[model samples]
Target: MNRVWLPVVAVQGLWLRSTLRLASAPGGGVSGTVPGPAAEPLRLAVLGDSTAAGCGVTGDEEAFAASLAREVAARAGRPVAWQAVGQFGATSRRIRFRLVPRLDDDLDLVVLLAGANDVLAGRGPDLWREDLTGILAGLADRAHRVAIAGIPPFIRFPAIPATLARHLGERAAALDAVTREVCRQSARTTTFLEQPAGTPPADFFSTDRFHPSTHGYRLWAQDVAAQLIPDQPAP
Candidate 1:
């Protein structure tokens, strides 16, 4: 361990404890079947960490995956069957090791929200890339389209100490860069980099100030759905 990181690690431990107590655990998986008249409903899977599991929000409807499904359904005029598989504090490697093996086949889309935990855990970009290679390869083989959402803006997260925020922000940016490269390398993948969208901080973030609130989830879903569903042809 770098000697300079010692104090940061100590602060991180404290922050981690506080985050756990304040941010709800990502326990039950999110799943729903949106009804439609299409012959085959769109099959979607979301895999990643706390945000993908919807740590800050209550109910599946309020989470990013479900909100995205609703948006896509409305755009495509078809039913969507979506499911989310994630856990709190899951790094990229953990998702590859644990979540990838259980993913269903014949998925139309798979959305991945990772990297923040990897950055916070001090994992380097190489490891992040290796993990994503495995995760994306699996999803690419199984799903028609794989979408990679950018890591959460840790620097802007209200729960983190200002002293540590700059350092964390740098790491998050590095990880997001790696994420972008991974997506770019694959033709089937779509990438979304999270940035300030002019939405009020209080409106988007939950009480924990780390994970997204329902409104935040909505914003993210809108972007994801737009990418998944292209503009319809003129009638």
Candidate 2:
């Protein structure tokens, strides 16, 4: 089926890329201080691709990384100091090799949101698992906890054509399964947070219809907050 759809997907992908180039807006970095009243400061790092970098939103406060920090702080009663390192088209392999080596601080938590590009690029599940294993190992020395953010519903994204989206979504699900297994095998790696596929795509997506909007960020943060501070009420 993918063979039959590949050419069509490729054509649509080219148009989609051009459209995104024109439609995508500059998203502010969601790094630095996420203020709270708690005396203890939590050092956090977010590592992955565009969604991890908060591509759809304009400001840091509106990005998922910043929103998660704020929610975690509100729930844990501690200040969360966070830094985000990601780009729009980065793959899991790139993140493991290029991005992970540059980290300079010990962190309380690290949130990883990637694999969408990997799925789109037709990376296999075995390779994804290997990359995830390496990524978690790399983070073991840097953070006390590593949280894996599961892939979104690529099939539901309005920017993606249905045929390509279905193939990508299936690949994303396969990669996510690998991620879950990797997390389960590691004590330092915690939960895999995911967006429900049943969700209305329009409500959670941004104007560009690919990356997350503020609403999506808030929802994702809520999920992360629940995992980070399980005892506290959901934010």
Candidate 3:
């Protein structure tokens, strides 16, 4: 079975509500209020692939955008309105083509979590770097605070084919390198979130082992929140 592109069933909405509740709990330490202008909620935009869209997770709330918004709001002491723009099989190239133009200048923060599809498509590092650079440049030029999430390790998942899995693993490393280089070159353009090693595939992924589960989005949201709020460290 060529399960490379198989779509994982979206989880139920109840799962999202439950996850949000847990993430919002005081013990969870996920909530943080963003203190700034009382002028409406801070607008946050997320762009990427299935992970960014919370494909494996059920409902929008279970996605990273929702969790991050909640956390940022709690910590920053302000309200946040999160907008997610993602596609299941999107790559960096596709993001450049489809998602970039839709971004609003009013967006306070932009989170980009892409490149896995580019890896699957066998895109070269140079091309990945080009597209990512252009994306970051566009955002920076507009004075939007941006953060680039590293591609998580996919080879550890059991559902993928061995050959494709191996390729993805190598590609992830290459993409990470290019991402770092771009971040260094871009002037205060994009912050890089390094994917932590040893994160169990099950904890971070859904049943299909491709998209992130609710837990996975939480983890990604934590990383994003840390970047947005330097005072708080991501666990």
Best by lDDT: 2
TM-score of each: 0.85, 0.87, 0.76
lDDT of 3 by residue, 1-235 (tens): 2355323212322333244321111112112233455767777877777666667665646777788887787667778877777777788888887877766676788888898879767798999988998787667644367888888776665556555465567768898999988778764757788776574645776666556678877877776786678685578
Model 1, CA-based lDDT: 0.79
lDDT of 3: 0.69
**What's the CA error at residue 90 for candidate 3, in Å?**
1.1
Quick one: ranking by TM-score, best first?
2, 1, 3
Task: Tell me the tens digit of each residue's lDDT in model 1 across 12-121.
Answer: 75876666455657633478988887558999888898888888887768888888888988898889999898888899999998988777888988888888889878
Candidate 2 lands at a TM-score of 0.87
The order by descending lDDT is 2, 1, 3
lDDT against the true structure, each candidate: 0.79, 0.80, 0.69
List the candidate 2 regions with Cα displacement exceeding 4 Å.
1-19, 22-26, 201-203, 231-235
Clashes of 2: 0
Candidate 2 lDDT over residue span 155-225, tens digit each:
77887888878878888889999888877877455778766547663578888788878998888788778
TM-score between candidate 1 and the true structure: 0.85
Of 1 and 2, the candidate ahead on lDDT is 2
